[model samples]
Target: MSRRSSFVLAALAGALMLSACANTVRGVGRDVGNTVDATGSAVRDVAH
Candidate 1:
């Protein structure tokens, strides 16, 4: 393969990997937020 083609492929792969990492991080943040909300709700219920 040509050097240009290899560079392009590498760049594309890097972009894909970065995007996947971003999505996974976003998902983890949401999961953490949900857990916090649930915990707060449980505490409120128990206090009531």
Candidate 2:
């Protein structure tokens, strides 16, 4: 039971770390592209 709990925790931590890294990379990429596109300013203004 203890080992199983440890494994679960480890797996969860690994997934969280991987997702964080992926999100960071994606966010950076999006930011660069968004800058080029003006970050959808027209859409945001309409929504607001």
45 in model 2: Cα distance from truth in Å?
24
Model 2 TM-score is 0.60
Best by TM-score: 1
Residue pairs clashing in model 2 are none
For every model shown, what is its TM-score relative to the native structure?
0.98, 0.60
Q: After superposition, which runs of candidate 2 have C-alpha atoms over 4 Å from their true positions?
A: 35-48
> Which candidate tops lDDT?
1
Tens digit per residue, CA lDDT, model 1, 1-48: 999999999999999999999999999999999999999999999999
Per-residue lDDT of candidate 2, residues 1-48 (tens digit): 699999999999999999999999999999899886775887787899
